[model samples]
Target: MLTSIEVAGTAQVPATDVGFLLYKHPDRVQQFATSQGGATVFFPAASPELCRVVLHVDGVGAKVDRAEGMGRYVNVVPFAASSRLVVVLGKVFGDALAGRCATRPELVDNRWPMTLTVPSVPTGGRCSPAELFEPLGWTVQTSAQPLEPPQWGDSEFVTISLSGVHTVRDALRHLSVCLPVLAGAKHYFVDDAEVDKLQRLGDGWLDTHPRRDDIAAGYVKHVRSLTDEAVMRLAGDVTTAQPADDANAVPERRASLARHRREWVVESLARAGARSVLDAGCGEGRLLAELVTALPGAQIAGVDVAPAMVDRARERLQRWRGTSVWQSSLMYTDPRCRGFDAVVLMEVIEHIEFDRLPTAMSSVFDEMAPRTVVITTPNHDHNEAYGLAGQWRHPDHRFEFTRADFAQWCASVAEEYRYRVTIDGVGEPVEGLGAPTQCAVFTRDDSSPQLNSSEGGRR
Candidate 1:
């Protein structure tokens, strides 16, 4: 009975930063005790080009008891990669998986090309590795490991090798959620906390995943009630809608606010005479759908980091001509966003860390160099009016900005990128506090001359 997990990869990000991201120094090994036994995490190889972190679990002391009549029999629990290992992985690298790296904040939103290898994973079912990961854009290769006795046939465990381009957080989250699903069993009992665990780890990609139900079932130990609840919640249905006066407001109000934001974004773009648009960080194609209807003749394209979101966007906009959706990260340079008349970041910038905003904005203004850029974010000043001060509207938001803060940032970006910027309020204004949403429209100074080619123009 052996239990061990290895995450080896060459990341496009700095090697030293990888250690900080994982919250473990590469030069030393850290050990933590588990109920069954204990686990050790160490970086066997750390370099500028490659790094390998291994989690080795020793289950020598683990035992299960069985009772027959008055006599009790005890046997050692099988220690192939199981839910225990997943639990340990979460404990060891939880911060990295959650996209929190205080030491190297910029890398939090960065998508780094990586190669991940899990030496042994218990896949009780016959499902192929490709079936589980390929849809998420991972290139997977699996090899079965045989049982000790040839007559016993092959074991449930397999060595998995995966290569893909993903943010470090995305890669870790995928492993955290999928590993337990692949194992198909948990050594410990499952409870309500398990449901919360599944949802938290599966945040961005789970709802629209093809095997979502199966993953949910596996995570909750196939408890039908728990699985049903998780599935409904993931599909955005389980939670009750609060009334408008409630601190958080109702789902209807939230939807209305989103609709208002999208409308204002389209209005600004139209006002600028933008006929070809790029919707950066477009989640689920909501704004893209609005763009199609509001600007009928415009060429619209949307890009998001989550494949599920991109897939949903594609489905939603399939009937609209000159509309396209794909997976991309605004934190990195993307050529597809180039040559657009305008790029819209509707209620998306707040989700990115403050330190990473410069990189993302530069990628859009410096690299893509669109003629106009429209951005919107939650106005923190209005939070108090809603009785939600000191709290963010969304769990993923790194920071909500006040009207002044937003204006200052926009002014700085406009000047740095050689654009004239105007700040405006969106949604219904609240006296001196202004609207619940703040927007900035940045128009490039044609006479200033761009460092890059000016392919931007009204289509």
Candidate 2:
């Protein structure tokens, strides 16, 4: 940690949450990364005589982009072993960032300015308090909101940024770097004037409160509340699609209604912090598109062995970006894709060959690695639930697991996957509601907060 620094030494910047004196130590970074259960991060470092920043990672090499005078983002694929973030920034030869750390710590924010025209705000990660009002100290408190996918082919992007500082100016400066991300919201710092504005807002807001430093926290809460309200309001307008025309459109109509229902359903789940989604034999791209819409910027994806379903998913999600979709059998290998924030395994889990249920589900969990996997199937115990009898059978359902049977199956897998499990079904029992639809929701002990806090949505 010491060898990489320039002779002048680094100035310390105090942070309420993530405070550390940053200095050039490219060499020590490799060691630090290894100590953190992370793979070594190797990237080119700027000349020691000029600027200083440290970089480390879990991969052989990362693509490093320089930050303002110093700092850089070492972009790499996520590590499956752990979620810890590894970053490196510094000057590169013949490029900028070749200087000592700024002496004027006053560049920090104190102002409390609001963004004038933030277009297409990314979900979960709009802007960290630091990036939103750079030059003004700031802080952030985020809550996830579920969304829906319109088309499988649509490209959707969501970013959840954070600012863990005490002043408004600092938050704004941080925001400047992250908001309006399409314009390259990579990195930012606050100047003195902006910092002053933030401090004033903090002082003025707290002037009305018993505690002075409480201003930033209160303001962040208020703003987050408003944001959530706005999202919920938008949700009220979306509903199940009405009946369609053409007899051939029957299947299409059912698909359409399901799509609409998916949006609200996913949103409701996200509000409660559900994780992981499984399209249980997601047919075509219908539910997949809806899942994308419902969970903006989620780490969610879809899988179907049918060539048609895979193609349809790709098409349906062309525009709604971020989450990736794939074509693969639920019965198969390569354990990296299993657990997730949540799983949607909707209608497909019931039909597989009976013996395959345990193995298939285990594979799904192992591949997706989600905290929770949401399951839905008809209530075989309640014939009136769906108006069916023991004699009746759907051509598609090979075998239906009773609530008890399903619970046991899930329990076995939970044990195998090292997760604590819980079960719940979709919809409630109404006096005249037709069939008893059953759903099960599960969560692993290790998954709760980590999945919930991830700045992405799942519905």
**Best candidate according to TM-score:** 1
Stretches off by above 4 angstroms in model 1 are 1-12, 63-78, 245-459
lDDT of 1 by residue, 44-148 (tens): 777776667777777655443231012233432335555666666677778887889998888777666677777568777434578779888999988888878
C-alpha positional error of residue 7 in candidate 1 after TM-score superposition, expressed in Å: 8.2
Weakest ten-residue segment in model 1 by summed lDDT: 450-459
- Each prediction's TM-score versus the true structure: 0.49, 0.38
Per-residue lDDT of model 2, residues 105-211, tens digit only: 34233221222222123323333333433333333333332344534442223223333323323232223223322222222211122222333333323233232
Query: Model 1: what TM-score?
Result: 0.49
| Candidate 2, position 116, lDDT | 21
Measured by lDDT, the strongest candidate is 1
